[model samples]
Target chain A: MIGLYIVTGVALVISFAFDRKKTWAGLKKGWMKFYKTLPSYLFLLMLISFILLLSEDFIIENLGQENIFLGLLFSLGIGSVTMMPGFIAYPLSRILLARGVPYMIIAAFVTSLMLVGVVTYPLEKSYMGKKATILRNIMSFLVAAGISLIAGLFYGELV
Target chain B: MKKSTRNYLLFSAFLIFSFISWLVQYDFGLAIWDNFLVFARDMVLILPPAFILIGLFDVWAKNETIEKHFGKTNNPMRFIYSILLASTTVGGTFVAFPVANALYHKGAKYSSIFTYVTAASLFMIPMTIMEASILGLKFTSIRLLASIPFIVIGAIVLEKYFEKTAYTLPRVDQK
Candidate 1:
């Protein structure tokens, strides 16, 4: 990310000397596109929060006092299907973790949170190559699930 | 009816699905204390407008224009700008996809678009905070760091492999 910042900055500086008009045009296009999306994003967040509210029962029941592996599996499944924002899930996760859910599942679930979810899938299909998107998602879910299991076991031993 | 109403009906269906899930398991029914849980769940979701906007952006943008900026070239400027753009754009990895598609149609290179999606989806601060809150800071740090290689390798490998697939898919301009 740092590398990108420096490189982009240099580009901007160079652009000013050679072609300010082109640079301004790109920035304006990007900014207009970005600002226009804000309201919609807020609405999306609200909708996600609502979806999580419906699944409160699932979280409270399945998320408590389980082996780490099961938790990981559950999280992965939910992550693949659900569209709730990570912010709402974070608090729910905290609640579950304190209740004795295995760290493995929690880890996997957290990983799944950002990487995989059905809600955003249509959009993904639109922007990315369909095959690539599906394959990447499958790989991510599997990796997330496995990483959680290993991390959970290690944490169990250490703590 | 209206889009909102349509979405509401769809949501009701999903709610019913959850209820069926509870019936099958029975263990997941609403506990007495946290009755408000269901309401709270509804607050965080992807809205119809957002979805529409994503689609519109995909449909409206020119392919060649986006490609010129983000295409698989090694210009340091394009690479840096693309990375920063990916990092700050907020949404699920999937939401970012439509943008990538829009960019692709506008002629963004396959490699840079892939990289942008990879970064946008995985490297967001929101994700980091969520992990830290749930498991602990150390765990969060480890997972975040670990994902870096996956993003890089995954984007590069898939970008090349998926190039033809994009051309095959329905373009917004065609419609």
Candidate 2:
């Protein structure tokens, strides 16, 4: 996150140096875009928090507690629907992996958590168009599943 | 309803629910509040600069330039370049989506945009390092390697599928 700020800061300085008027306009445009999208983000945050609270136990238990197929399905479903920042999701997956959970389930959860965002699909559609948003999510879901299956096989020793 | 008002209503509804939960059970309310605050703080940490960079990208990069680089072509170089650019980007999926949309509006190919979106989420440096440290090098390596071909293939298929979709609105054309 600090890296993002530093890069943004430097880019702003360069933008200003190159063209003051354009830079100001760009900043205004940025704020407008940010503001325009802020509501969706806030709504998602609220929904995610509530979902997180409700699923705290459910996720911990069902993500890896069943047959491989069911566990994979559960992980993919939960991860797809839930919106979590990478920071939180990665560490949580790590903990799950350390706890003797199937790596396939952990992989599915982490991959889907990053790639598929059902919770934010509307927000994504606002930008990418409805068809494109749905297509992207479907592709990501399949790719995430593929990644998990491959990881499961290649890293079988870990499991 | 106005967009702002609609959003405000949604937020207030959630707030009311939280308050009622608090009245019914203190810990539930506190937990909800804590989760919201954590997300809010992370958003504060990331959104400002991410959006600013996006704004700068809009101001500086030209539509023709984007098209020239990422527009429909069978050129393998474009694929490599698109993946590299998106993979190294700092923010997660949400932050990358608008930038990819901007590129799309600028006439970049849908496949390239899809590739960028997937790569941005999957191959971020900070996230990769974190995953490696936590999940072990073997798991991280295998997953990363497995994902590349799928991302490439998915990008091409999506591009072909969405080829008819028109570019919506260019930022520079936004008045």
Candidate 3:
């Protein structure tokens, strides 16, 4: 994060040096874009928190080892809809692993969690349009499933 | 209703729901609030610089340059460039979206933009390091390797589909 700030600072300084008016215009444009999207972002945050709170226990209970296919399905389903930081997600996956959820299931969960964004659907649609957003998510879901299957076969846990 | 008004209404409804949940179950409401605070703080810290960078890119970067490298060329190197650029992204897709939008308006091909967006989520350096530490290098490596081809293919296929349909991106007013 600090790296981001440093880069932006240097860029801003250089931009201002080169052309003060254009730099100011750039800043104003950035602010306008941010302001326009602020509402959607707020809604996304609220939805994320609510989903996380409601699904925590349910996720744990459903991702057990009794049924592999069911577990993978649950992982993909939950992971696609929810968004959390990597720190929280990795630790949660570790906990799930300790509880005997197979590597394949965990891989499916993590992959889908990172790649697919059902929760970000509206926000993405606002930028990329509905067709692109839907296509991207669907493609991501397929990729997640494929990667997990490969991980499963590699770990010999799918059988 | 206007889109912004609808969003505000939905946001308020969620807030009210949280309040009701708090009344019924204090812990659940507290968790939601805490999560929201953490996420909001992260967003506030991260988003401004991202937007600023996008703004600068929009104002300064030449359209001809974007077109030369990432535009409607048949060059496979564009995908590589897209992924390489994406790996440098600090925040998640939130940042990537605006950057992708800037690139698009600057004449980048749809396939390249899609590659950038998808790869942005997967190839962040910090996230990869963390995943490797927790999940083992083997697991991380396999997933990364698998992702490259899938992302490229998916982007290409999606681009083809869009082209066949003569689809154009919907323009939201910047002002």
Candidate 1: regions farther than 4 A off: A1-51, A64-67, A129-132, A146-150, A153-159, B1-70, B74-83, B126-135, B164-170, B173-175
Using Cα atoms, each model's DockQ against the true complex is 0.14, 0.60, 0.69
What is the C-alpha local distance difference test score of each model? 0.57, 0.80, 0.88
Error of 1 at A87 (Å): 3.2
In Å, what is the interface RMSD of model 3? Answer: 1.4
The TM-score each candidate achieves on chain A is 0.69, 0.87, 0.95
- Per-residue accuracy of model 2 over A67-102 as CA lDDT, tens digit each: 787788889989898877666777778778777788
Q: Where is model 3 more than 4 Å wrong at Cα? A: B12-25
Q: How close is candidate 2 at the interface, in terms of C-alpha RMSD after superposing the true interface residues?
A: 2.5
Question: How many backbone clashes does every candidate have?
Answer: 36, 0, 0
Question: Per-residue lDDT tens digits of candidate 3, residues B97-141?
Answer: 878877888889989999999999999999999999997898889
**Sorted by DockQ, highest first, which candidate order results?**
3, 2, 1
Model 1, position A73, has a per-residue lDDT of 69
Candidate that scores best on TM-score: 3
Q: Which portions of model 2 show Cα errors greater than 4 Å?
A: A157-159, B16-25, B164-175
